[model samples]
Target: MKGFESEMIQRLRTSDGWKFFGVLPQANRGLAVTWWVLLLLRGILPALFAIVIGRLVGAVQRGQDVVGPLALVGAVYLPLQILAPLHRAIGANLGSQTAAWLYDRLVLACVRPPGMGHLENPKLTNDLTMARDFDLGISGPPMSISMDFIASGLVEMIVGLASAAILVGYAWWAPLLLAGGWLATHWLLRESAVWRDRNTEEVRDAQRHADYAYRLAVEPFAAKELRLFGLADWTVDRFRSMRSRLVELRFQATKLRERPVLWSLLIVLIANIVVLGSMASAAADGSLALDRLVTYASAAVTTGMIAFGGLSWALDCSAAPVAAVLRLKEAMEPAGALVLGRQPADGLPAREIRFRNLTFTYPGTDQPVLEGFDLTIPAGTSLAIVGQNGAGKTTLAKLLCRLYDPQSGGIEIDGVDLRTIDLDAWRSRVTAVFQDFIRFELPLRDNVAPGGAPDDFIQSALADAGAAGLADLDTVLARGYEGGTDLSGGQWQRVALARALCAVRLGAGLVLLDEPTAQLDVRGEAEIFERILAATRQTTTILISHRFSTVRHADRICVLEAGRVVELGTHDALMAAGGRYHTMFVLQASRFGTEDTEEEGVNYDVLT
Candidate 1:
C-alpha cells in the first residue's frame, strides 16, 4: 500500500498525472455529495438489523424484551432495501445519458467541425477514435463507482469500526487487524487502477480486434470480395492474431495486479476468522449476550458490501480518461457559435477571373500540386480545360470553385481577393459537379435537391438537365427501393446533372463541371454535353474533360500541363496553331464525331 501510494505521488506531475488527480475532484464534486447521501442506508440499516438480531437472540436467552429493537430495525431495513435498486437504477440511466451526450458531441466535432481538415492530422485522428470507443464503454463503470464508492466506503468504515469496538474488549490488536483488511482492499483497488491506466492502449487494441472480427461477421460490402477472393481465412487469421496479442498484453497487466488483489482477499478471510472466534469466546465467557453476539456477527458480515463498493470506485477512478476524452469533445466543438451567416448582399460579378502566380498544395502534401500558374477567364464566357492524368486539370476546376484557397499566391474574382470575401456567399455564387460524385441512396427529388432547393425549382432544374422523367420523384424512387433496384449508370448521371442544374438555377454565376459525362453512354454523353452547352449560356462555365469532342460547345479552349496553361484560344484558333489541342482534338474526333482541324478561328456570329 505504501509502495503504490508512493508511485502515484511520484507520477502526479505530468499532464496525464495531473488528470488522474484533477479528475478525482471533478468527478467527485456533486456526484460525491449525492453518493454519500444515498449510501447512508446501505451500511447503517444493515448494521442496525444485525443489532436487532443480537437483541432478539439475547431476549430469547435472557427471557427479557427483543420486540422493540426488532421492530425498530425492520422499519429502517425495509425502506433501505427498497431504495437500493432505485438508486442503482437512477445511476444506470444517468450513465447511459451521459454516454449519449458525449457521443453526439464527439461525432459532431468531427463531421460538422471547424478546421475541416483536422482529420488528416494523425494525433487528432487517434484521439477521435479513442474518444468514440470511450463513450461506448466507460459510462457504466464510472457512474457505478461514483455512487457505490461513497455508500460502501462509509458503511464499511462504520461496520469495521463498530466490530473492532466490540472486539476491543478481547484484544487491542483486533481493531488493527480489521483496519488492515479494509485498507488492504483499498490498496488492491489502487493497484488495479494503476495497471488499467498503464494498459489503456492495450484495452483499445483488444476492442479493435473484437470490432474488426464483428465487422467481418456482418457488413455487406466485405461479403462479395471476402467470398470471391477466398480472403475469409486471412481476415479470420488477422482477427485472431490481433485478439491474441491484445489478450496477452492485458494478461500481463492483470498478472501485475494479482498480488494486491490476493493480499486484500487474504486479509478479509483472516479478519472474518478472527472475528468469529473472538465473538464466540465472548459469548461463551458471558462477556456478551447471545443475541448481541448474533447482531455483531451479522453486522461484521455486511462489511463486505461496503468493501466491494469502495473497491469498485477506486479501480474505476483510474480509467476515467475514457470519460475525459468524451468531455473534451463536448468542450472543444464550436457549438455552431462563431459561425457567421451568409453575406447580407450579393457579390460583385466575376469579371476577368485571374490567377496571378497562384500556388497551391493540398493539406499535409509533400510538394506543390499547383505552382506559380497565371491565367485568366473572361466573364460570360466558357473555358474548356484539357489535360492528361495528374496534369492539374481537375485541380483548376476545384480552384475556380474555391473548394480550397491557394497557398502562396492569390486568386481574384473581378480583382477582388477571394480570401477577403465571405466564403459562404462566394460558395453560393458557384456550383460544381466532379467526376467522383456522391451517389445518394435517397428519393429522386432529394438526389436532385442535395443543396435543398425548392420543389418547383428542383423540377425545373431536372427538366433542364434532361431528367423530366424523374421529376415525379416519390413514386419513381420508391419503386426502386421496393423492388431492390437502383438507377442505371446513365440514369444516375442525369440525376447528378439535375442537382448541378438546380444549383445553377439558384443564381450560381459560375458552374464548374469536371468530367461531367464520364459515366454516360455515347448517346447520353451527347445529350448531356448539349444540356451543358445550354447551361453555359446562362452561367460562366469551366469544363474539364478528356474527351475532346465535348469541347466543341465550349467557347474557348485552354491546354494545361503540370498546373500551367500552355495554350489558350478558341477551338478553331488552337487547332489552326497545330498544338496539343489540335492533336488531341483530331484523335478524339476520329474516335467520336468527325474531327475538323483546318480553321483560323470559330465564327463569332454563331450565338449572335
Candidate 2:
C-alpha cells in the first residue's frame, strides 16, 4: 500500500498537465488567461445545468408560472452551445502556438551544450527522438490537456456534491451510497492508468523504430538510395513489422484498460438502480416530489460521466509526454560535466596556439583518437594536416575548434587555456567549411550571409570563392522557392566556401577547411585552393586534406599517424627526408603519372 501511494505521488508530481499549465502563461500570457477563464466556465456548467433543471421541474409540479425558470434554462443552454465550439477553436490555436514555443525551447536546449557529447549519447538521442514525436501541434506538451483534466475533475466533484446534497434531503445515507460507488470507479480507473504507464516504455521503443523506417522510405535524402538499392519493399516491410508490434502492445494495454472500464460500468449500473428505486419509493410515499427526483437523477448521471470519461481519458492520453519532458530535463546534462566558462576570447591569437599533451577518445569508445598529441600553429600562417584514413586528422581539427575537449591535457590560445575562454566568444573568431557542409535550401545571398552581411561583402566573398556568376542569376538556390534553380555539386561547394569567406570578412580570424574541394575535379580543386589561399593570406588557416598538391602550398605540413604527429616541417624539408609524407606523395604522383600514361598509350609499369 505504501509503494502504491508513493508511486501515485510520484506520478502526480511528474505529470505534464500541471507542468504544461505552469509554462503556458509564460509562453503566451493572454491566451493562457483566456483559456483558464473558459475552463472555469466549462467546469461549473454542469452544476448550473442541474440547478436550472431542478427549478424548472419544481415550478411545473407546484403549478407556478414556469416561464422564468424555462427562460433561464434557454439562456444557459444557448451560451453553452456557442461556447463549446468556440472553446475547441481557441484551444486548438493556443495549442499550436504553445507547441511552436515549446519546440523552440527544446531545440535550444539540445543545441546549447558546448560539446557534442550529449548529442551523441544513444540514450539521449532516443529521448530527443521521442520528445520530437511528442512535439506535434495538437499532441505536444503545450496543450491544456492537464488543465482540462483539473477543470473537469473539479466539475465532477462540485456536481457530485450538489447531487449528494439533493439526495441527503431524501435520506442521509443516500449521498454516501452514491459517493462510495464514484470513489470505487475512480480507483479502478487510476489502477488502469498505472498499468498503462508501466507498459509505455516498450510501446515508445517500437514507435521510434517504426518512425525511423517510415522516414527511411520517404525522406528526400534517402529516396535515391532506396530506389537504387531496391529497398522500397524492405523498408516498407520493416515499418509495417515495427508498426504492428506497436499496435499489438497498445491493443494489449487497451484490453487491460477495458477491465477497469467494465468494473466501473457495473458499479454505475448497480448505483443507478439503487438510487432510482429509492427515489421512486420516496415519491410514492409523498416524502419526495417528482421534480426533486428528476433533478437528483440528472446530477447523478452527469457526475458519473465527468469522472469516468473526462478525467480517466485525460490521464490515459497525457501520461507519456509528461514523463518524456521530465526525463529530457534530467538527461540534458550529464553528471559532473564541465560548465561552459564565461571569460571572453575577445582578440585573435596574437602569437600562437598550442596543443599540449592532448589525449582524447570519443564517447562510448575505449581507444583514444588522439594520444599525447602536441603541435604549435603560428598565428596568421597556413598549416596543413595530412594523414591516411582514421589517422585522427579531422579529430585534430575538431579539437582545435573546441567541438570536443580532450580527455586529458588541453589547448592554449596565446598562452591562455582554451577552457577558461567563453565558448561563444571563441567560436565567433573561428569559421570552418567542413567536408560534409550543409547545403541550405535558401537564397544565394542568404546562403553566403546567414548572419546578414552587407551586399558588397557577399559579392566579394562570392568572387573570392569563384562563384561570382551565381550572383548574376535571379533565381534562388533551391527548387521550392519562387524562381529557384538547383546547383551542381561543385557549385554548392563554392557556395559553402563563400559562406566561410564571408564569415572571415565579418571578423572571424581563423578559418578551418576540411577537404572543401572533394566535390570538384582535379583542376577545379587546385584552382579553388589557390583562390582560397590568396583570399585568406593574412588570416590564420588550418587545412586538412588528402591531396599532397594542396599540402605543399601551406607554410608547414604535419603528417599524423595513429593520432600522433609522425612528421612535421615545411614541404621541401619533409620531401627531402624520404619519410611517410614523402612515400605517400610519391605514390599519389605515380598514380597521376599512370593516368597520364594511359591517355598516351604507354605502359608506365614497364618504364618504372
Model 1 lDDT-worst window of ten? 599-608
Q: Show where candidate 2 strays beyond 4 Å.
A: 1-11, 111-116, 133-169, 186-192, 195-201, 257-265, 312-347, 363-367, 388-390, 473-475, 570-608
The number of the candidate with the highest TM-score is 2
CA lDDT, candidate 1, residue 65? 73
Q: Give lDDT: candidate 1, residue 50.
A: 66
Residues 1-608, model 1: lDDT tens digits? 99999887776543343444344334434543454456566555655666666666767787777687677768877876776776666545444444455556567766664334344443344355556555433322443334344344446665555555554544577656765676667556545355444336556556556666757856876999999999888888877877677667656655545465677778889987887788788889989676666766665565454344343333343334444464456544533222333433164455667889999776657677789999888877888888777878877776665555677888777877766667677778887888877777677777887657788888877777777875356633534466433776667777788888888788888888888777775556666778777865857888887766566668898888788888999988998999987777666545433334222221111110
RMSD of each candidate relative to the true structure: 7.1, 4.7
Cα lDDT listed for each candidate: 0.64, 0.74
User: Tens digits of per-residue lDDT for model 2 on 443-515?
Assistant: 7888888779888899999999889987443457888887888899889999999999998888888899998
Clashing pairs in 1: 54-291, 58-291
All candidates' TM-scores? 0.73, 0.84
TM-score of 2: 0.84
Give the distance in Å from residue 76's predicted Cα in candidate 2 to where it truly belongs. 3.1
Query: For model 2, what is the error of residue 152's alpha carbon versus the real structure, in angstroms, after optimal superposition?
Result: 7.4
